[model samples]
Target: MNTNEYPTHRLVKSEDLNHHGTLYAGRSAEWFVESGFVAASSILNPKNIICLKIHGMQFRTPVKPGECICYTSKTVYAGKSSLAVYVKVARVSNLESIIVDGFITFVHVDEHTKACPHGIVIKPETEEEKLFYKRASELGR
Candidate 1:
């Protein structure tokens, strides 16, 4: 896989906040899945893709309102019909502070919404890529 990082950002607003004034989990999840979908759709037609699973999502830090959250996603692994997308969300002002991270699995489907072979193949060319690929492959098992 290429080392390119597909990025999307959202600003935390009053409507996006929880009772604690932090970003809400449901809102975060919606964006996280959208990020993964964008990453997977870059390789496969968006119309042919559907989310198959969402692996562990861990929120390590709270994001407050008015903060610009950056979501970076990458295709970590590719199988015959599925792709594992790893996503990381952090504050744009404080990149070191990761708010959440997770993996989302997407599969290519036909017009009937049945899984179909995407014929997409990815080979890791860097150590970091290799590590992510290994981790994503494990999710499939």
Candidate 2:
């Protein structure tokens, strides 16, 4: 795969927190999907893309207020009309610790919002990419 990463950063504010004083799941999900969309759209027209599914989201840790969370997304797999994007969320100060990670699938559509082929193809070039490509294919099945 290209392994091109699209990164987005967000500051955890009071409004982004939950009752337990940590980042809310809803907010995180929104950003995660957005990041995935960016990755998918990078290879296709943004106006022709729509999110089809969120395969899974794993939250390994909680994010607190004042922390700058970075969301990095990359396209790991692509089918005729769909792309699987993997997103990783971590603190900018400590990229080693992943706060969350997930895969989202997006489809290319025509002007009528019907599924259409996206002519993009990705070839895995590394062991990590190969693993993610395999996982993405399994998710499609």
Candidate 3:
């Protein structure tokens, strides 16, 4: 997938810093997974998807309260009913990048059986998608 094809969302009340201050890691994680789901669903079957797991996530900088946190996500690869999504969280103001990023993986399963089918349905539709596929491949996913 190309970089532009990645899905992105701005800050909302649900995504906020914890009582201890700074961004809540759990909220950030939830946003990341949700972003992943959005990206994957856009490419494949939206109704049948579920977040299977978060592979690796590292916070380089803390997102503070009232800051506009931006989450960008894209599908890196598709296998049958499953797709690996990579998400990046950053603080943006006047369009400046404040943080780097991380990733999450989601799977598409049968609504009833919850079993993953076997075949990539969403092929790269644009240059951005192709680029994401390349990047995901480089990461060994």
Candidate 4:
């Protein structure tokens, strides 16, 4: 793990689950996207951000209600006004493991025209970010 990498924050919501007694897949996906948003914004433009799209979602397990869901995200790649964020989710309560993992794409847009502006800056502060950028670039093509 990269020491400089930002530690993920926890997100909890009572209405995020479904009647199945387990966390809903849709809710999990949304949370994952939100996590990506948090991570991307913190690195790219801490003040303003916008989610462009959710690329894909994959669930490894189901999260339970009352369990603290932790979403960890990192800046994988950035270009102009767009940044790709990779995120992973874990269900914690008395020590549990990952329940889901995914990635989200965000575009920094001007609030007025809602168009992606030029010269958006993203600084990769760790080796992890560099490696992620390389990997993401390869996969992106």
Candidate 5:
């Protein structure tokens, strides 16, 4: 993992499960946005950050109790007033096997809660990062 990628962990429990006895989508979504927010807030003021959109949620594996998962996110695209974050949910035991993956966008706001520029720019440095940046840039627009 690179420095840009932030990781958050969650331990599955009964309360976090669904009728099928796997982790609930609601709970998973909560963690998804929270970690995306962290990735955004890490570079900007948390008080000035607000989530704008969460798209492309892809759940590939069912999480069961006793399974530990990681939510790793990074700012893949940064615009004048917005950032598109990419988050991947994977079991700690197998990081390459994604359990879920998606994009979350956040906007920097002024004290009046109006969108404002954050004065940050992001450029992809690797081929993989370029792919992520391309996809995220499409979302930012």
Candidate 6:
């Protein structure tokens, strides 16, 4: 496990695949963003946070029916009013084979939907953490 990262599972079915018989990019993206939203909401009020940027979602494998995908998400960086979450999706059968990965940036907002500081800080302890935090910070610019 990576810090407070959590696993979210989704079963592959007919509706999730594209015409070419592989998982649809659109569907994968939906889950990616949803996982990031869940990560942010776990720390802040769900109503107080909204997605700002996706950074990027890189698809690395093709998934077919009968395969279960696991999405692992964690808040990697907290800056002022923005929080960045890193997510990795892979099949449950092969944990080492990553199907997709990305970083998503979210902003904390007030009741009026304006950006507000969350006053939280995350100290990157290991090299991996530092790398993710660095990449997340780049999305701000």
Whole-model Cα lDDT per candidate?
0.90, 0.92, 0.67, 0.66, 0.91, 0.89
lDDT per residue (tens digit) for residues 1-141 in model 6: 234887899998999999999899999889899998988888899999989888778787789987899999999999999999999999999988898898998999999999999987988889999999899888878
Give RMSD to native, each candidate. Answer: 1.1, 1.0, 3.6, 3.9, 1.9, 1.9
What tens-digit string does per-residue lDDT give for candidate 2 at 83-117? 99999999999988889998999999999999988
Stretches of candidate 1 off by over 4 Å are 1-3
What is candidate 5's TM-score against the reference?
Answer: 0.95
Per residue, candidate 3 scores C-alpha lDDT tens digits across 62-100 of 676667767777667766556778777776663456364
Clashes of 2: 2
In order of appearance, the predictions have TM-scores of: 0.95, 0.96, 0.73, 0.71, 0.95, 0.94
Tens-digit per-residue lDDT, 1-141, candidate 1 = 463579999999999999999999999999999999889988889999999888999899888889999999999898888999999999999887788898999999999999989878888988988988999999977
Which regions in candidate 2 have their CA more than 4 angstroms from the true location? Answer: 1-3
The most accurate candidate by TM-score is 2
Relative to the true structure, candidate 1 reaches a TM of 0.95
What ranking emerges by lDDT with the best candidate at the front?
2, 5, 1, 6, 3, 4
User: Candidate 5: misplaced stretches above 4 Å?
Assistant: 1-3
Our model 4 lands, by Cα RMSD against the true structure, at: 3.9
Error of 2 at 91 (Å): 0.5
- The residue pairs that clash in candidate 5, if any, are none
User: Judged by lDDT relative to the true structure, which candidate is superior, 3 or 5?
Assistant: 5
Q: What TM-score would you give candidate 4 relative to the actual structure? A: 0.71
Clashing residue pairs in candidate 2 are 1-123, 1-124
